[model samples]
Target: MITKVTHGWRPGGLVAYLMGPGTVEEHVRPRVIASWDGLDEGWQPDTGPGGALDFQLGRLIGALQVPATRAGLPVSGQAPPGRGYVWHCSARLSATDRTLSDEEWAGVARRLLDGAGIATTEDLGGPRWIAVRHADDHIHVAAVLVREDTGRRFWPHHDYRGLRCTARELESELGLTPTALADRTAARRPQRAELELAARQGVEPARTELARVVREAAVAATDPGGFVDLLRGRGYLVELRRLPSGDPIGYKIARRATTPIWFGGGKLAPDLSMPKLITRWGQRGDATERLDAGVLAETRQTLERAERILRGARQGIAAENPDGIAHAVGDVVAALGARYGGALGEAASCYDGAARAPYEPVPDVGSVGSELRTLAGYLLRPRRRHRDDLDALSTVALLVALAALVQQIAQWRAEQGKRHQATAARDAQRLIRCTAEERRPRRGPPRPRYAREVAVDHSRRENAVAAIT
Candidate 1:
């Protein structure tokens, strides 16, 4: 797992996106120093005129204290035990690489609280919530900051930028690398390249946008209501406000809605808020509930079978058995049923291609072609006497190919200095291109708003929207 810290934003957005969700349980508060002693009196919230900046700074100070405050910690005038006395700031954590199970994700939150010197408030019946979003390859988590000792309320302060470095330190403690934020690109003229292209086409958007729109429409179909239909009609979720109460609500659910929220009883919908829906559905004694349980059971069984195939392939990779390798690969591909679903075939290919290259005297640059041939012969002979297992045979072939690739690349760096420099360059280029190809978007076509047919084709155009789980 990886943690990416985004800081230096205006506090309002950061706080709303973090603490405003109203689900994060307070674990600690007054996370930093107690009070401002030597600073100007104008720094106070109720200060002199022109207090906007000062007010923000004051809010920052309070926000820093919120974690500890929620943790029931007092504002420490003097240096507190085990607490680092330095600059104050705020930060948010995003997980990368792999999706986490609910239990695994809770553990992450617990670690963050403990590592950051905020005592856990589990005893106080505090709520701990994880908001999983799919817009980016990261999970947005929010938790209330509480005081462990006094059980007091703590609010987040305004100036929270310094937490960037602090987050990195905490991430290291949890056995994760801090994902660095990419820098902004150089600014250009007001008339942008994408805009110009859209303007010239004058009808539909480029192929990319069309594909994106289709994907959104597809996933939205999963919602219980006609959420998918709504997205197709408007291209985005419709914003609406309730009168009298003035509570904010939206009509259409977003195309990609993986948010896990904790709310009152009326908000229950088996297909809407899935995690809670599942939990609630499992608790009831009804025919529908029983059917849902059976469906889940079947899904689990299918996944288990796939896992077995993948495990076998991994074993083949380790043992260097060509037939076993081929069998494993075939099993995996067959289990995927051609759709590929969320299988990491491309990543596996990288490893496989590297592993199965023809084995020359020097390692890492050639295939073990002879071994693969021997393994293939063994499998073919056995099949002649008995029923052939197509999937198993395919697995063996894939493993052999992977082993050969690995061996071929082993001595790649040996081509150093002037003599083999050109060969090295070519190898590097090939590797880069291959990796890029693996990651390229599988969906085709772009959709832009200005195209003549863009609005007409609001419905899903492809079967690309799928939930891997």
Candidate 2:
């Protein structure tokens, strides 16, 4: 499950977008899962048989607006008059979870809204919202953020994080597959426009590519200087933040030599932060490095190539041609199978080695690997039948699954790199300290006190004889 929350100053446009037929298809009408009114009792709008859809929509919008007007709050300076705080959110279940009924889904939506502190009874005085089920496996909820009786506004604190936590809890309760939680420090992913550009240009998106490069460089380089040089060789412009005395405090990366836009290392990835890197490379000097420049570069290029292949396949799928879809699915299956299989094998090998050590148990990557292989097999022989039997929706699901698997593998590999780097750095530091101790000079044993006094008296007598002569 995933939840997206966004707020605006107007409800009419948002309500229309959710309830309008244009959201799904011209022929398919959206289903009103549930509706409520804060001002009136038994005010469920007529969305039943023989009821006018337009009238129901108007009633829905009116319910959303009445609270804002009754609150008597000033219009948001960011928007024009008659526009107040409108809280819009969507909760989407995985496409595979298609057995849930409209009522069940609505319950999930309500729980999420309440958890996120958006449409709570205490906050709004009453339920003043509507949940619309779209053709897709998702529900859209629109509510007025202003209280109807007290004229108070409700702003959710840390709304995104709250939504994520609620979604995770719901996933467990609903017996759904759990997904990786969002990293608070992770940069905003590439937008749809950037993805489309990458597809059109037949190149990997800059943000994704940059993140991959940064992660690899962070693991392979022995010291901060080496890390900077490694990134420079990879065609990324590196900017280092320094103190007045010329000590590096932080760093950022640009996509190329000429780009003015830069992303902080932490923004690119949590592990790529300057402080994290310093911790990984303790007592940093020229240490024994494991991964060389060639290996790192090759790995990055392979990832980029795979991304390009996936993008091309997605383009073909978008065309909606039967033959094209088959070809696309085959290409994706082939490319991702090899990549994910290799990653899984590597992870398994590392896990085996770590298991021999007395350290904590390594997580079982075998299960994830097995899942990836199963997904690959599904793509290879969908429906246990011929390719001609493949439906568009099934093909789309396969594509989404393939993408998810790829991302999972990438994350696994990144984590493995961090562990390897830490181990290598510790070994290197031990070696350095041992070598320094071996080379250190030693002092001769101290002479006895009587022997030292006799030598001193002899030297003094010789000096007196020379002075007399």
**Which candidate leads the pack in TM-score?**
2
The per-residue C-alpha lDDT of model 2 at residue 46 equals 55
Candidate number achieving the greatest lDDT relative to the actual structure: 2
In TM-score terms, candidate 1 sits at 0.21
Candidate 2 Cα errors over 4 Å, as ranges: 23-27, 35-56, 67-85, 122-128, 149-154, 171-188, 243-246, 257-259, 283-469
Q: Which ten residues in a row have the lowest lDDT in candidate 1?
A: 181-190
The TM-score measured for candidate 2 stands at 0.53
Candidate 1 Cα errors over 4 Å, as ranges: 1-22, 30-395, 403-469
Give lDDT: candidate 1, residue 286. 23
- Cα-based RMSD of candidate 2: 25.9
Q: Residues 1-469, candidate 1, lDDT per residue (tens digit)?
A: 3343232312233333332223453222111111222122222233336432222334644544454455544544444455331222222345443444444444444444434443243444332222322222233433334443454544334222223334455566555545432111111122345467558857433322322332222222323234335444754443333447853232323322244222221121111223322222222122221223233232233323333433444444432333222222222222221122223233332222222112111121112222222222232221331222323433333333332332233233122122122232234334433433454446667776577475555433432333322
Candidate 2, residue 456: Cα displacement in angstroms equals 88
